[model samples]
Target: MSRAQNETYLLPFDNRIEINPALAGLNKNSSYQTGNQYHFVNSEQTYNLFYASWDSYSNKLKGGVALNFSQGMLSGQNISTSAIGFYYSGFPIKINNSRILLSAGTEVLAATKHWAVAFLNNVIPHDNDAPIEQGESFFRYYIFKPKFGFLWTNNSLQIGITSTVLHTRDVAFSLIEPTTTLGYTLYVSKKVDKRVRDLYSRPFEMSPELVVFYREEATIARLRLLAEYTDKTWGAFVQNDFTNHISTLGGTIGYRHNFMRFNLNAGMGIPGISDYNSFMCELSLNIIVPPFSHSKYNPWAPAKN
Candidate 1:
């Protein structure tokens, strides 16, 4: 419905889409990183509730919800600023596979409001809103992470290396800059009993990873091919979206069964389909479950020096 309503008022969370990975892998990898035999669950499992959203149609209220600091207003609109991200990565070594993780988050909003409040988790319209003057997460950019990966599963194949900082400042409304991102994953599990179910459920996996994205001047890359099914409750993945080669082709759909994990990531741009054809949707939630490596032991087990 936006024909041209440029009121110089852009703080509705800048409308969100794809969201760069929306905190990546749920805590650090999306639904696709169930690699290294599904280890690395450093704990920090929130989502009793977290909020964000924005859809469009500005004079006020189009898909409402948005929140960063929240001043008030949802449908009538008026909370002009937002940003809240708190991620946790655990597994300092309770035993099992050697793993370490530290995920961080922080945000500020304006130009309308950022992430549009992350889509109704804040409760409102439904589909992005929030921005006041965002130049891409203005003033306060956050993401300080530390990760170490290891897996040597009797030679079937499993490799790991991770580092993420995407962008950060010392704190509050901070936008220090330079940005950095590099991630990795590899998987192998082929039990495949194929009778009905339950022999470890039905295993067959092949995951390849090389995701490096850095932004200051520039750098972006991706190479992810995954297929998985790991369970405690549920974890699933199906991916085939090469970053470039004309954006190649894209596909991703995830469901983390039960406690609540859902990702409907999208990307289908073969030159914007005639003029503008886009696909990017993310509705993430992990409100609070912070403490990891499977809480006590067997985080997947791969650290025995």
Candidate 2:
């Protein structure tokens, strides 16, 4: 039997990384930050992401850009699919206080598939409320959505709120409603102990996050609780997601040696439902670059008189 004859179907790609300027920093003293992540699901779908940002203290500014590429395939078919998107975050504004900063960003996405054209043309309505474009082979769209949020931190407590997909343009289907396009997230973190700040000089912490998603026909909400402990050399974390009374549990262990950090994560769905009840594993590696010597002419560097 061919590999395609013995394949399994899985859920569509829904996970996304929402860039936050506050979490991208190495420290208050560091000026540059960059990282990359790769994700695999059900041994079939794969995603890659890259992001980098520069910060300036004198001007109280932060700016960055990110890219996402994903590919997946259906079982028992010659069909293949992929999507590419780019994200850009502009300079952040300081909120008059040293503990708060507001930032904004936008993203554009394009995808290719054999059935996208047919689905948009036949399945989706072309009414006044649902505006779509005519195209062949590949479907291209722009999401002029702007994301803005404020990050506040003082000592061991941190809080953030980000609004994403506030608006949409050239939407091609009614199934994609404007109200459902809007996304909101709230996150809070607290350090549990001052002495246990070990993994990489960061203390043990607990965070709870809530995300509200407006769908074309319904509003969906999800909650996640995460606890982590880290030192300079090793770290570990446990996370749980609650939705519709079902909970998924996962954990990660990581180690930092010299300039490289390695992480491994495994997760399982609770109340295993059919094909969805299975274990998922992901591996990640990050390269840490040392801080550069302060330069008077570099805008990213803090000013020194």
TM-score of each: 0.20, 0.54
Per-residue lDDT value at 143 in model 2:
36
Rate residue 12 of model 1 by lDDT.
14
Task: Provide backbone clash counts, one per model.
Answer: 78, 10
lDDT of 1 by residue, 1-305 (tens): 11111111111111121122122222222222110001011132100112343211112321112112222122222222233433222322323643332223333322243245433334553343443322233223233333333322222333333333433332323444343444332322232233445443456444444443333323334454545454222222222222222232344455555434344433443564222232332234322232234424676765452
Expressed as tens digits, the lDDT of each residue in 1-305 for candidate 2 is 11111111221111223434334342333233334434333345433333433433332344433344434433222233343434433444544443665565554433333364456556666563342343333342233446666567666666777676634332333354433255566655555544434543435455554444432323334444445455332233332322222234556566756655555555565555423343545455555455455766785777563
* Model 1 spans > 4 angstroms off: 1-73, 80-91, 97-100, 111-198, 203-305
Clashes of 2: 10
Question: What root-mean-square deviation over C-alphas does model 2 reach?
Answer: 9.7
lDDT score, candidate 1, position 13: 12
Q: Over all chains combined, what TM-score does candidate 2 have?
A: 0.54
Model 1: worst 10 consecutive residues (lDDT sum): 33-42
